[model samples]
Target: MTLETEFRTRAFEDVRRALLERREIALLDVREEDPHARSHPLFAANLPLSKLELEVPLRLPRRSVPIVVLDDGEGLAQRAALRFTELGYTDVALLAGGVRGWAAAGGELFQDVNAPSKAFGELVESERHTPALDAQEVQALLASDANMVVFDARRFDEYQTMNIPGSISVPGAELVLRAQQLAPDPTTHIIVNCAGRTRSIIGTQSLINAGVPNPVTALRNGTIGWTLAGLELAHGSTRRFSPATDGAVRVAAAAAARAVADRAEVGRTTRDEARRWADEAVRTIYRFDVRTPHEYESSHVPGFRSAPGGQLVQETDMFAPVRGARVILADSDGVRANMTASWLAQMNVEVYVIDGLTPADFTEEGVAPPARNAVTPPASDEISPAELSALLQSPGTVVLDFTASANYVKQHIPGAWWTLRAQLADALPKLPPAQRYVVTCWTSALARFAAPELAELTGKPVQVLTGGTSAWLAAGLPLETGETQLASPRIDRYRRPYEGTDNAREAMNAYLEWEYGLVAQLSRDGTHGFHVI
Candidate 1:
C-alpha cells in the first residue's frame, strides 16, 4: 500500500465528534507557525514539522495518545504521520484533506496562536462577569492619580515594547503573589492589562480568584483597546515588580497563595511522586521549574525545564501541547507552583506542585535532557566562516539561512535564501540547481540538524556554517538586509497585529473583532473542555 493508505485518515467531523465527546486526542496542525496562524481549527495545536522530533517527546510523551496531524494540502500531513510512526507513536493518523477539509466541513478557522485559551478567557469574562474598565475610564484614573496602580500582565519584553504610562510589569501568574507588594493598601484599586484581552482578563480574575483585598479590574481589551481609543502608550518602560524585602510580606503572600491553591483543590506531589509519574509508560508527564528564567538558569532540579509560572499559564498550549498530559511544577518557595497549579487545575490540566523540596534539592542541578532524536553534526560537514566566504565567491554554491524570519530580515549573508527548515523538502526542488549547499541559522544548531537531512535529500555534499550568521558577523563579513533570494515563502513566523506600533489600525480592529467572535466559535467547535471555576 502507498504511504497515504498506510496511515488512517480522520475526517473533520470525526475529529469534531471526538472533541465534543471529550475523548483523549491531539489535533495537531503540522505546518509552520505563520500559515497555522493564518487559519486553523479552534483546538488545533501548531506543531511545526521542523521541530516535531524535538517537541513531541516533551509535549506528547504518551506514545499511544491518538494524534491527528494536519496541513494545508501541502503533503505535510502524511510526511508528519510517517515521522510520528518512526518515533514509535502507535496511534497516529492524518487529518484528511488537511485544514481545507476542516473548512469544507463547515468548521470555523481561527487566526492566532492559543485560540482556545484566549477564547476561553472571553468565555470566563462572559460567564463570571469579570470586572473591567475601558480605555477612557483607565485614562481618567491615571490622570486623577487616585489610589490605583496599573499592572501590565504580559512578558517583560512585551511590557518594554509598549505599555500604559505608569504600569509595572507583573505578568499573569505573578499578579496574586506580588499584588500585595505593589499595592499594600487593602482599598487600593488595581488595574491589570495585557496586549490584548486574554492576559488582562485572566490576570484580573487570578487576583479575584485568590481573594486579594484590593478591588481589581482588567483594562478593557488591554493596550489594543487603549490604542484604539487614541490614548498614548509608553515605550521602552523598564519598570518591574520590586523584590519583597520584608520577611512578613513574603510569609503573608505565601500563606495567601497557598490558601487559594487549597481552596481550588490543587494537588501536591513530591519529587519521588513526580519521578514515578515520569516513569509511567502509559502517561505523559511534564516537569517544570516555575521560577524566573534567571533563577532557573542559575540552578534548578535536574531534568526539569524552566517555565516561568506566569508564561506557562498564559501559553499553556505551547508549553504543554498535549491536552491530557500531567504537569508537575516546581518552585523553591512553593507558593508560585501552588498558585500556578491552581489555575492549571481550573483549566482542566492534571497539575501538581512539588512540595517540601529544599533549596539543596534545586541546587543539585543539570541542564534539561536533549530531545530523544536530537541531531549531532559531523565535524566533517561543517565549514568555517572563512571557508564559507571563499565558497560563496565560487560558483555553484547555494546558501540557505534557516534563522527566524525576523532575524533573517534584519541581516544575513548577501545571497543566502531565507528558508523554513520544516519546508526543506518542498523548497529543495524549487531552488536553482547547485553543486553544493551550505546551511546557516542564528546559531548553527538548527543548521547542523538540517545539514544531514539536506545531504540525504539532494545526494549532494552539504556543509553547515560553523557558527552560523553570528560567526559571519564576528568575521567582519559584509551583511545584507531585506529578503534576498527566497527558496520558500516566509511562512515560518506569524506577525501579530496587536504587537508593535507598525500594525495598521484596521488590522487591530479586525483582531479585536476576531477575539469578540471567539465565544460563538467555541460553541460551534464544541471540542474545548474548558470549565470556569
Candidate 2:
C-alpha cells in the first residue's frame, strides 16, 4: 500500500485539539532545519528526517506515543511515516496538507526555533510580574561604580559574540548557584540579560525563586532591547564567573538550589533509580549531565549526555522533545542539577536529579557516544579522505556535503555541493547527473546515514566520505571557502539576528517586535500548555 494509505492523517485542528487537551502528542516537522524554522506550529518539534532514526529513541521513547509528522508538501511526511513504521513506532500519522495546510487552517505559524519556550518566557514576565530595568537605567548604572553585576544568561558562545559592557557570562541555570558568589553583598542589585527575552526572564526568576538575598531584575528585553535603545554591546568579552574557592560558598549555593527544588517539588533519584528508568520500555527517560562542558568532558556519568544547566532550561524542547518524558539530571556539583531541575519542573517536565553518585562513578570522558545501533553504515559503503580525493580527480563523481550551512560556508571540500539530507529528493533532480556520488559532513555520521538514501534516489554508486571534512583537512587536502558549488539553497540553518558582531539593525528590531507579539499569538493559537508559576 502507498504511504498515504498505510498511515493515518491528522488535520491541523485535530493536532491543535490534542495539544490543547494536553495529550502526549509529538507533532514533528520532518523537514530540514531552515525550512522548519521559517514556519511551523507552536508545539511542532523539528526532527529532521535525516536524524530521525538517531533521535527518535531519545526524543520519543514511548513507541506507542501518537506522532504527527509534517513537511511543507515536499513528500517528506509520507517518507517519514514509513520510516516511523519501520522503526516500530506504533502510532504514526502525517499532518494533512503539511505545513501549508496548518496555515490554511488558520493555525499561527511561528518563525525561529523554540517558539513555545520563548513564548512561555514572555508569558511568565506578563503573569509573574518579573522585575526589569530598561536599557537606559542599566546604562546609567554601568556608568556609575554601582555595587551591582550584570549576568549575561546566554551560552558562553553567545555571550562572547555580544554582551552588555560589564556583564559576566552566567547562564540561566547557573544564576541560582553562582549568583550568591557573584554578588555576596545582600544590598547589591543583580541584573540578568540574554540575546532576547526567555533566558533573561527565566534567569532573573530563577535567582528570585532561589531566594537570593540580592535584589534581582531582568535587563528589560535583553541585548535586543539594549541595541534597540541605541546602546553599544561589548564584543568578545571573556568575563565569566570564577570557580568558588570557598567551600562555604559551594555549600550555601547547594542549599539554596535544593530549597528551590523542594519548593518546585522536583524529585530526587539515585543511580539505581536511573538504571530502572532506563529499563522501562513504556516511558521516555533522558539522562543529562547539568554541568559545564569542560567538567562534563573531563568526567561524566556513563549514558548521561552533557547539557549544561542553563542551556538546558533555555532550550528544554531541543533536549527533551518528548514533553512528558522523565529527565534525570546529573552534576558533580549538586547545585546546578537541582537549580536546573527546578526550572524543568516548572516547565512541566517530570524531572529528577541523581543524588549520592560520586566523581568515581562519573568516570566516562568526553560526550557520550550515540547508542551502538544508532548508525552503523556498512564498511563497503565508506571511502577515506585520500580515496575520495583520488576519486574526485575522476569526472563522473558528485560530492554532496551534508554539514550545517554555517560550517559549509566556512570551509568545505572544493567542488562539493552543500545539501540537506532531508531535501535530497528535491535536490537530486536539479544536480548534474553523475555515475558516482560521495556524501560527507563535518563528521561522517550524517554522511554515512545519507549514503543509502542518496544511492537509492539517484540509482548511482554512492559512498560516504569516511570521517568527513575534518578527516579531509587532516589528510592535507586543499579546502575551498564560500558557497561554491550549490545543488541546494542555504536554507538548512536560520541566521539569528543576535549572532556575530554585525547584524542589520532592522532585523534586530523586527525580531524583538515579533517576540513581543508571541504572548498574543499564544492566546490565538490556544495550544501551548504553558503555565507561569
**Number of backbone collisions per candidate:** 0, 1
- Which residue segments of model 2 deviate by more than 4 Å? 1-5, 11-23, 100-108, 378-380, 500-503
Per-model root-mean-square deviation over C-alphas: 2.6, 2.5
Q: What TM value does model 1 have? A: 0.92
- Candidate 1 lDDT tens digits, 1-533: 33555788899888888776656678899899988998998878999887676577777867888999999988788888887887778899888878889999888888888887788788889888999999999999889989999999898999999999999998776777788878999999999999989999888888887788999999998998999999899999999997453577666767777887787678888988888777776676788888777778778987688898878877788888777677899987756888888778877777888888887887644456675535344454788999989988878999999888789989999899888877888788778889999999988777877788888889999988888999999999999999777888877878787655375688788889989998888887766767777
Deviation (Å) of 274 in candidate 1: 0.9
- What residue pairs are clashing in model 2? 173-310
Work out the TM-score per prediction. 0.92, 0.92
